[model samples]
Target: MGNGAKAQQRRERGGKDAGKGGKSQLKVNEASKSIVCGTCRQSFMTTARAPALTAHAEKHSKALADCFPDFKV
Candidate 1:
């Protein structure tokens, strides 16, 4: 087969399923952690990294405090 034809065959076959690896292929082994905001009573994915969660909390603090003082940080 020509190079073009070989390439077409490879494309048709598709590469190994990238999505079928690691945590994706299997179900989550452990329950996800939870984040409860003291000021807003909002719950977030505790599974997310601490830095990301901190950034998210920082962004929402102003709005949350304004809306619900009971839950504000």
Candidate 2:
């Protein structure tokens, strides 16, 4: 098969295990306007904004980093 065909085939095969691991466990609480981390069960008020959610997620990421120095979230 040609290169383009091979690339298309790979895409059809889900690009070789694209989502095998490393999934986000963050969940949003619409009623309370907060985001909670599934791993740590930590919650923070989001005020229905992206920045707040991002900041809260970063906190969880930092906590994970403390445990695993090389871990990326």
Number of the predicted model whose TM-score against the real structure is largest: 1
Off by over 4 Å in 1: 1-33, 60-73
lDDT against the true structure, per candidate, is 0.54, 0.54
1-73: candidate 2 lDDT, tens digit per residue: 7999989887888966875877544443435634455556654454435454455557667543343333233
Candidate 1 C-alpha lDDT tens digits along 1-73: 7999999888777766644656562234233435556656655554555555566567776444343334323
Task: Write down the TM-score of every candidate.
Answer: 0.31, 0.27
Each prediction's number of clashing residue pairs? 3, 0
- For model 1, the local distance difference test gives 0.54
Worst 10 residues of 1 by lDDT: 25-34
